[model samples]
Target: MLRFLDAGESHGRGLCAVLEGLPANFPVNIENINKELERRQKGYGRGGRMKIEKDSVEIISGLSEGKTTGAPMTLLIQNRDYENWRLKSQEETFVSIPRPGHADLTGEYKYATGNLRNSIERSSARETAIRTAVGAVCKEVLKELGVTIRSKVQTLYGLNDTFCDLFDDGLYDLIEKSPMRVLRHQEEFMALVDSAKKNGDSLGGWVYASCEGVMKGLGSFMHYDRRLDGILSGALMSIQGVKQVSIGNPFYIATGAMYHDGITYEDGKIVRTSNHAGGIEGGISNGEQLEVYCYMKPIPSLLLKLPSIDLKTRKNSDSRYERSDVTAVVPLSIVVEHVLAFELLKEILNTFSRDNKEELLAAIEVRKIRIGEIYEKTTDY
Candidate 1:
């Protein structure tokens, strides 16, 4: 299985990630990974940090002549803002008050420290930049196999009942060009973000991600740990500020007829009449588009600080102000898109298990043929 370990502080020297289990001779592009990092930094509500850091990946190992050597890969993304922070004295950078929705207090309790700066540094969303670079590498692998992943901000400030079609592939172009990553209501979303920024507050929203060209049976139904939906949802929830994840259309209050996808026979193949199940059924890919929805809570580092108690003084005080976005739903859409690429590529590698790129593609093609045969056999009955 593919895996990666990332380390770095928010304003430390830089970010580093060690990725493992990629097949040999796969083409790896540094520019593509840099492009992903650029995408992660864009959006209207972004903070001054984005202005200072031009995020890019530096491949330290595991590639020769632009191809993988079947060894572990090391990636680095240096933080430009770290230079300024390094000038500050240790006492000047200390944090005694913890943010309410952040891991500050709990992290201090876990480490038995009065200072929450250590917690804040690791838990910062800046860490996601390295992960995004890792996923960008995985995306190259997926792109070679004809998989396409896309995402968009479906709602802002908890607004629902919109007419946006989350499943429409045509919206990809519009979403990619829009700063807010919304299919429509761009002005409304921007206004909300501007209003929140003016009020020294933050806003939360929902992001939708989809993947296509995934063949059947990437995950197993026999084992609980191997379920694709569970695995994907867990990976998504691991992202900072992502509070809830829904695979397919989350219809906890609906009947089977209302939520379940119906099957139909089409040209000797079994097809789902609708993709309400989000292309996954029985813990496996059903040869349809995979869809995911994530709800990201407002960032905890609000400019207008919420109430909190000082760790040393035990007196009530407002939270400390930190440089942060008013709303990150747009950049979050990019993060969601690439992160799913990593998970999907991991599952594909686990299922196919080939050490060579050509051999892996061949294995996937054979699986596709097998799926077709199985579909035909099922449809005949």
Candidate 2:
């Protein structure tokens, strides 16, 4: 029953989010939440806005002494750039020419607003800041239940040069330092980013996310609506500009080999040897690390202008340029992690049906015992 809603415009005073249904006595980490926000603001090709805003979250309610109070949690992220936008004249207002590939014109039409400024303001990527905050909270909840979510950029604009030895200790470090969050061929990827920026264009990329320590059978195959994969995909696709989703491999290789993870037994425990199904099969988690990959389209608001029709005049015109990132895949990856964390938390809560951290952990322990008993009696793979 966990849910959240975010409100505010890109250049408004700030963004606000309200999260409800989180259990009481769950530990709240303000610093870690702030760090996630900071991560979302990083990445190569970011524009002047990143330079102006130092994002921080203010917890206004539902937290007391670093623990949830079982009430709705309200968060605030101030827009430091609001001062610069505050004094603009109504006549010298922002552009009315909606950029192609952006939500500007459609939002204006849907909201019945003649001015496109209102459309772009709310549809901006800036709203992801609040979502990051809410995801951070969900991360805290999952952490309490021994679940961890991490993400890294897989490729940048089809450049796969950032690959380090996947097993090397330096892989994590390299990913953390990378502006594109790529771990493979650093120099080549950097070159591509530089070239894109020089041309006033943008780049797209992919991200790989892994979740460890999630227990099996957290979702039910009995009903399609209750499926974990459906929930995860829906949550991920909600992010703007996400073009594709992959559970594990982007392409299915096996023709008639089931293409699904089969159950097995190991050390008197039910498990699977290979996770071709990406830790899920039959719409449920199978006690394996959940792997998800997302493809992000390049930022739509390009620095170089494009063609568009003026909303008022209905005449073709050059689209107006706005300060925007040349690439947002890196930050988008972090945002993806936050959203996935939220979905995982929802699934866990739905399966365990606990009201607090202690109760949830106890319920999980009991389920583990039940699975262990079943494992001992089953001999077939």
Candidate 3:
């Protein structure tokens, strides 16, 4: 199985990750990683920190001559802000008050620390930078195997707009270049964020991902832990400020008549009329476009402070103001794509042993043939 561990504080020296389980001879691209990092930092309403930090990855091990060495891969993303932060006095490092909708105070209690910075540094979404870098690497593997993954921002601070469709991979590049990462209503949404920033509030909204060319039966139904939906949803929920996750049709959209995907035949091939199941049923991919939705809460660091207690003085006070984006849903959609990509990589690795590029492709081809036989059986062929 593919596994990874991330280290380093938010404003510390840098972020580090050690990812293992990739087969040898798979190309690892530094330029791709850097490109994903650049996307993660872009988006409207971002704070000053985005201006200073230009994230790039340094590979310390598990790669040689641009390919994996069949060992654990080490990745590094230095925090440029750490240099300036180091110059501040010790008192400046401490945030006495916890911001509402943050892990600050509760994390402080759990760790029993005097300064909330202890918790703040690690809990900050800054950690996702390295995770995104790792996801870029995983994405390379999936891309080579013919799985195309992409995501789009659906809503911003409840500003209603048409959801971006991921069914067509041709538009993937356009969405990636887009400022708001939406197919429509970019100007209006940015204006809404501009207004929210003027009012010192933050915005949150929905994003969803889709995958094409994914073969059926990557995850298993033998055990609860082996369920693909359970694993994918768990990974999505772990993203900071992501409140909810749903596959295909969410609960509110599901009713007996409108809910289920109906199976059918098209031009001698079995097909699903609607993808209400999101490509996976019975804990396995079903050869349809895989889709999942996520909801992220507003960023907690507002220009105006929320009510809280000052840990230092033990008295009621407003939370300390911190630099933050008025809205981060745009870049967040990118993160969600890679996070989901990593999970998809895990399930693929579980199904195939690819010591080299050719083997991975051959394995995928074989799986598709076998799945075709299953489809024929379903169609009474």
Best by the lDDT measure: 1
Candidate 3 C-alpha error for residue 246, in Å: 0.9
TM-score, structure 1 vs. true: 0.96
lDDT string for model 3 (247-366, tens) is 884634557777778987786588777788889899888888889988999899987767899888899998777788888888788899889889899888888867667787788889
The TM-score values for the models, in the order shown, are 0.96, 0.94, 0.95
What lDDT does the true structure give each of the candidates? 0.87, 0.84, 0.85
Error of 3 at 302 (Å): 1.5
Residue 65 displacement (Å), model 3: 1.7
* Model 2 per-residue lDDT tens digits across residues 26-115: 999999999999999998778889999999999999999999988999999999999998998977675678888889888977997777
**Which predicted model would earn the best TM-score?**
1
Write down the TM-score for model 2: 0.94
Better of 2 and 3 by lDDT: 3
What's the candidate order when arranged by decreasing TM-score? 1, 3, 2
Model 3, position 242, has a per-residue lDDT of: 95
Per-residue lDDT of model 1, residues 1-381, tens digit only: 799999999999999999999998989889989998999999989999999999989998989899998899999999999999999997988989999998899999899666899999999999989989999999988989999888888788866524345446576677778888877778888888889999989999888888888878888899999999999999999999999999885634677797788888888777787788888888998888898999999988888868898987999998888888988887888889878999999999999999989899999989888777877787364
